[model samples]
Target: MRGSVVCKKIAPVGEVLVKVFPTEIIDSVGEEDAHFFGAIDTATRALRGGGVFSVSDEIEGAALLHYINVAESYRNEGVGSKLLDYSLKSMKSAGTKYVLYRETADNPINLIISYNFATDNGFIPIVENEKILSYKMETILGGKFAMKMMGKKDSLNNIIGIDDPKDNRIIKFNEDNSDVFYKLEKGNYDPCYSGFYVKDDKIVGALRGVLRDKTVILGDVYLETGYESDDIYTSLLEYVLILLTQDVRVENIVIQVTGEKRRSIINSLLGEPDAERNAIELVRYL
Candidate 1:
C-alpha cells in the first residue's frame, strides 16, 4: 500500500476527490469556482488512497495551495507528502515564485500538526491564532526591515509626482479611467480596487488593489516594462499605505509579487512581515 501510491493532477471530479475534499470546496468546485480552478496553470487533483489537492493559478503573482485532504486511513501512509511534492513541482514549473497555505486554528492539535507539517516542508508560521494559522514557505532573505512612511500628507498630485501646478490633476480610479486602463492592461492588469499614477495628463503607472474579507490585497504596482524606476514604486505603495491608514476597518494588507524586483520593493515598503490578529494566509516563494 505504501510504495504503490502515485500522485498526479486530476480534474476536480470523480469519487476520490469528492470523497476527500472539504465540503466547502466540493460545493465551490460544483459551482465552477474558476478563480479556484479555471486557469490552465491551476492544478486540482486526486492521489492514490483517497487523497486530493489543489493549487490556484499565480494570482497577483503568487499561487495559493487552496486545498489538500488525505483520507484518515491514508494519513499515516505518506499520502500528504506525495501530493504536496507533486503540486509544488508543478507550480514551480508554472513560474510561481511564491506559494501559500492556510489552515483553521480552532483545534490546537490540528494547528500544531499543520504547523509542523509546514515547517517540515519549508514553511514558516507568520500568523498564528486560535482562529486561523497562516504559513508562508521559508526563504533566506538578506534580513528584515523596519517599516517607514513619508511624513508629508499625500494626495493624487503628490503621488503622481506632479510638480507643475498648470498640469496638476488628480484621477481617482473610476469609469472614466477605464479607457486608459484597458489600453495599459494589455491583458495583464485586472484589478478589483486600484489607483492610477498619472503624470502630465498621461497614465505612467498603476496601483491595483483587491479587498477580500477585510484584507486589502495589492496586485500590481506596474509601470511600463522599460519605464519602471525606484521612485515610481515608492509613490505607488505610499499611496496605498496612506489609503489603508485612513481606513479603520481594514484588518490586513497583502501584496502579491512575481519576481525579485517587486518583492524587494514590497520588502522595502513593508519593512518586515507582521502577523494580524486571528488572521491566516499562506505564502510561498520560488
Candidate 2:
C-alpha cells in the first residue's frame, strides 16, 4: 500500500470508503488492538498505498489514535503526513470533536517528537492508571439466565441501596431525594447502554458491551451485595452468551476484570484457556 489516492465523499452512505490496503500492511503495526482507515486513488479508483491505524472507541466524543504508518516504499513522500491530515478532516466532517493519540513510553525513536504531532493537532495527554498482570481462568459453567433493559434511574438507586453501607459515598444514589434517579429519568444520563439480569422485577446483576470491529467486549459485571446466589451469576453469564450468539459480526468475546474477583467466575463460564496475557497499560479517550 503506497501512492497518491483521490478522496471521495459518498452520500446516502452511512459508512465512508477511503482506500482499502492489504490487511497485512495494518497487522505490521504489531498491536492487535489497532483500528485502521485507508485512502483511495481518484484516478485508479483503487485504494492508495498508505493508511492510518489507531485505537478508537465511542467514548468522550473522540477517537484514540495509537499508531500511524505509511507503507515503507512510500515513506518521506508526504504520503504519511497527508494521510494524517485526511484522517482529521474526515473525522471532523463526521462531527467528531476531539482526537486522542499515544506513543508507547518506551518507544525507541523520537517518542517526544511523535507526541508533538498530536499535540500540534490540538490533542493533549491524559494520565491514567497503568495495568498489570492479572490471573486468567479457563472455564465456567453455563446455565439458564434472563435479561432485561432497565433505566439507570431505578437500577442505580437499587444498586446504591444494596451496596456496602461503608461505601455509600462511592455513588450518590439516594442523596437529594435521588437526584441521580431524576437525571437518569430526564435523559440527562446514559449508563453506556448496558444489559441486566433480573428476577421478579428486581435487578440481580448487570453487564455492558463494547463493540470493536469484529469483537464484542464485555465488562463491568456486578452483582448485588449479599446476594451470593449461584442462580443470579449464572443468569448473568447466560445473558451474555445469548447476546454474543446473536452478534453475527463478532468472532470472539473478551472480558476484562481484576484477577482476584474474576478467577472463579471465569473458570466456571469460559472453560479452558484459549489465550492468556496481561494488559500492560490501557487508556480511554473519555
Candidate 3:
C-alpha cells in the first residue's frame, strides 16, 4: 500500500528536519541552517513502507525539497513520486512560485540516486556549481506561475521604477520615521545606511544598506505601491555610494537581492553584474 501525503502550512523545527533526512545529509548542510528552514511552511508524506519525505516553501519563493528518506524495502514502490506530486499540488494551491532541490555532497552514489530521481520526476538542473546540484520543478505549478508573472510585467515595472512626484530629493533616515523603515523591510533586514524618498513629507520609497568591513551591502530597495516613473532607487543608491566613498575605508558596494527578478533589475541599473564567483540557485516557474 502506498502511503498518503500530508502537507503542512507551518514549518518544522530542527528536530523534525533531522528526522526527515539522514545524518550524512544533515552534516553536510549543518544544523545551523535549520534556523533558516524552520521558518517556512512544510509538506510531509508518509510512505506505507515506513518512509517519509518532506519539503518546505522557503525563501525566494522556492519550495525547497529538503529530504526524502524511504526504507530500503520501499525503494522501487513509487512512493517518492506520489509524495512529490502531492507536495507540488499543495504548493501550487498556496501560490508557490518555484520548487528547489539542492545536493551539496559529492558522493557519487547519492548524487546519481538524487539526480536520477529528480530528473525522472520532471525536475531539471538550473544551476550546478562545484559539488552542489540545483533543480527546478516542472510538473505541477511551473508553467502556471510563469504565465501569472508575465501578466504582471507592467505592474512590476512601475513598482521597480516608481518615483516621488513632489520632489526628487533623498533624505537621511532619522529616528522620526525609523518605524516606517522597519515596516517596509519585511525580512532578513539589516539597516545601516538607510534613507528614503519623500513626497509631500511622506516616505513613499526607501533604500536600505549595511556597511561592514569596508563593503556596503545594499539591502532592500523598494517603493510604495501605485507610484510610477520614479528613479528613487537609482538616486538613493547614488547618494549612498557618494556618502560611503567619503570614508577612506569604503572599497566596494554589493546589492544582495532576494530573488532572480530583483537581482536582474538591480544588476542592470548598477551596470555589469559581477562574475567573480558563481552561485547555484534553483528556480521553478510556478
Candidate 4:
C-alpha cells in the first residue's frame, strides 16, 4: 500500500521510491512483500544503504510542518494519515501554539479546504508583508525643539489635557487606560519611548512607540486635531528619527501611514525624493 506521512517539528524521511515488478517476483514475494521489498530497495539505493535522518531547529514560538511520501504501491493503507497524526500530536505536546501547511496560492480547491481545516482546528489566518521602509536623517530641524521626556506617573490626566473640550476628540489622553498599558509603561516607558511637542507647560502633540525585538514601532500620533498641517506631523516624525538615530544598532525604522496622508505632506518636507519613490504598500493582519 502507498501512503504519505505528515509531521510537525520533525525531519522527513531521506528517501522515497516507486517500484514496478514482473509477475514472477510478485508471486514469489506475495503482493504485500513485493511492495514492501520494492520500497525498501528503493530507499536503500537512494541513501546508499544507510539510514537518513532530517532534523530542524525549533522555531521560537512556531511549529514546523513536513510531509513525506511513501511508495504508491502501498497507498491507502493508512500510513500517510497515521504519520501526520503522530507529528501533530507531538507538536501539540511540545507546546506549539500554531501549525501551518503550505499550498499553492492559485490552488483554489485546496485553499478552500485548508481554510476550513485551519479554522476548525482553532487557527486564525494571519497575513504578513515583506515590504520595509528606510528613513534617514537628512537634516536636523530647528535645533531639536526643547522637549522633556516625562514618565506616565507624573500625571496621565495632565499630559493628555482630557478636560480641554476644545481638543478632546482629536487629542485623547489615556485612550488605552488598560492594565496592559500601565504595565508596559512601568516596564519599558522609563524614558517614555515616545515623542511630544510642548508649548508652554502643556503638550501640543505626541507620538508613541511600542517595542518589538530591538526596534521600536511608531504607533499613534495624536495632535490637537485642527493642527493637521504639515508642520506638526513633520515635527513629530522628526522627533522619532532623532531618538532612533541615537541607537547605532537600530538598522531601520517603521511607520504605518496611509498613502493619502503621506502624499499630503511629502512636498512640504526637505529630504531625499528617492525615499518617497521607494515607498511600499503596507499590509497588516486584523
Candidate 5:
C-alpha cells in the first residue's frame, strides 16, 4: 500500500477531489472560500490520499496548505509525507518564501499544525501576528457582511457606532501622512482601506485593512493608551467598516485583532469568535 500512491502536482479537481476528501470536508467548503484560498496551484493524489493548496494572497511569498486528507485505508502509510514534501518543493520552486497552515489552537492535532507533522516538516509556531490575524474570521462575519452589503444597516444596527461620519479627525490614510501611524514603514497600509482618528492634533487612533479576493482584511487597529482609548478604537473601527462598504464591494470581513478590549469591542460589533485560543499561524520557510 505504501508504494501504490503516485504523488504529483495538479491532481484532477472535479469529482475526483470530492471522492478523495470526505463529504464533511469538501461539502462545507464554498466556491468563494475556495476562491479566497487562491491558486488551484496544486492537488495531489494516488492510492486514495490527496490535498489542496493555495497561495496566501494577503501574506506575501507564502502558500497556504488548505486541506490534506488521507483515506482511512491509507493512514500512517507515509502517503501524507510524500504529498507534503512535493507540495513544499513545488511552492519553493515557484518562489513561495514559506508555507502557512492556520487552525484553532490546542486541539488534538493542534488543529492544522499537526505536531508530529510539524516535527517531520520543520514548521514552526509564530507569535508575532496572532494578536490580529485569522482566516476563520471569514466564517463568522461573512454573512453579516453580506447583509451590510445589501444596504441592511439595520441588521448590524447596534454595532454601527458612528453613522454621522462628520468627524474631521478621521482622515484618510495615504503615503503623505503615513507617519501618523506608529509602524508605518513596516506594516501593511493601503490608502483606500485605511484611516486615522486624530484628536488634540495627534493621531490618537487608526485603522487599516488589506483587500484580498472578496474579503477586506481589517487589521492594525491602534490607539494611544489613554482614558478614551476604548471609545477611540471603537469609532475608528466602525469608521473603517462604514468606509469600506460605501466605497467598494465588500463581501467578507476578516479582522486581525485580539486582547480583552479589542475582542470585547469586536464581539460587540461583529459578535463573539471562538476566542478560546489564538489562531495559530505555522510557517515553514523555504
Candidate 6:
C-alpha cells in the first residue's frame, strides 16, 4: 500500500466530510468554527482517513492541525504518515508552525489515530529536528465552569441535587480495571480524583479528573447510554464535585466537556457564559 497511497486535497464541505470524518466531530463544529475550518483547502484521504488544518491572520506563520483520522483497514499502510507529510508540504512553507488540541484519548478510536500519528501518549513528532516538540497542555475552561474562581458556596450550590444516584462508589483506576476505565472516558486513564459508577462490580459510568496544584482539571465522562443517561451523568459529575471539595489542595476545577446541551447543563450550574481559556495547543516550527 506504499505506492498505492495517494494524498489529495478535498474541499471541506459537509458532503465530502461525511465520508471521511466522524459525524460527532462534524456536527460538533458550530457555524463560526465551520467557516473557519472550511476557509482552507483540505483533503479526503480514504474512507475514514483525512486531516483538517487552518491558517489565520490572527496568528502569523502558525496553523491549527485540527485532527487526522484513518480507518482501521488503512492502518500500517502509511496512510496516516503520508497524509501528515502531504498536509505539511501543502502548508505555508518553511518556518511556519502547526499545533493541535486533542484530548489524549486512550480509547480504540484514539489509539488507532495515535498509532498513525506516532503519538506516545497523545502527541507525536513529524521530524527529528530541534523544531519538533510535544508536551501536555493543561486546558483550562474559563467561563461558567471555572470552579476555582467561583466561591465555594457558588460551586457547591450548582452541583447539589442534580440527580440521586442509587449507589456510586468513587473508583481509583488500577491495572485490573484500567481497561474498563478507557471505555468510560476518551482521555488517558489517571487514578487521581477520577472514578466510575459501579453496579455489581461492573463499571456503568465514569468521570476522570486530574488534581494539578490548586486546580483540578476535569476530563470527559463516559457512560453507557441507557435509561436516564442525563440523570446518571449529572449524578456522577455532582458526586465527583463533592469528593474533590473534600481535598484541601483543591481550590479550583477545570472541566472540559462537549455538546451544547452538556455545556448548557454546566452553564446552569456555573451561572452564565464567561470565556473559554487555553485548552490544547501544539507547536511545531518548520
Q: Which candidate comes out best when scored by lDDT?
A: 5
Please report, in order, the local distance difference test score of every candidate based on alpha carbons: 0.51, 0.45, 0.46, 0.39, 0.56, 0.50
Give the better candidate number (3 or 5) by lDDT. 5
In model 6, the runs with Cα more than 4 Å from the true position are 1-83, 86-192, 277-286
User: Tens digit of lDDT per residue, candidate 6, span 18-122?
Assistant: 766667665655324532211122343234467766554334455556667666666776667677767666774534555433434424464344444545323
Clashes of each: 8, 18, 4, 6, 2, 6
Best by TM-score, which number? 5
Model 3 TM-score is: 0.37
All predictions: root-mean-square deviation over Cα?
11.9, 11.6, 14.4, 15.5, 9.4, 16.6
Q: Which ranges of candidate 2 are over 4 A from the true structure?
A: 1-20, 23-49, 52-68, 75-82, 99-139, 142-206, 210-216, 220-252, 258-272, 276-286
Model 6: lDDT of residue 166? 34
Q: Output the worst ten-in-a-row residue range by lDDT, candidate 3.
A: 132-141
Q: 1 or 3: which has the higher lDDT? A: 1
The true-versus-predicted C-alpha distance at residue 94 of model 6, in Å, is: 25
Residue 25 CA error for candidate 2 (Å)? 11
The alpha-carbon lDDT assigned to residue 206 of candidate 5 equals: 59
> Which parts of model 5 are misplaced by more than 4 Å?
1-6, 11-13, 21-45, 56-59, 104-116, 127-191, 196-206, 210-215, 220-235, 244-252, 268-278
RMSD of 3: 14.4
- TM-scores of the models, in the order given: 0.44, 0.37, 0.37, 0.33, 0.54, 0.38
Candidate 1 ranges beyond 4 A from true positions: 1-3, 14-16, 28-59, 128-282
- Candidate 5: how many backbone clashes? 2
Query: Candidate 5 on 39-100: residue-level lDDT in tens?
Result: 12123424466666666545557677767766766668776777787777877787888877
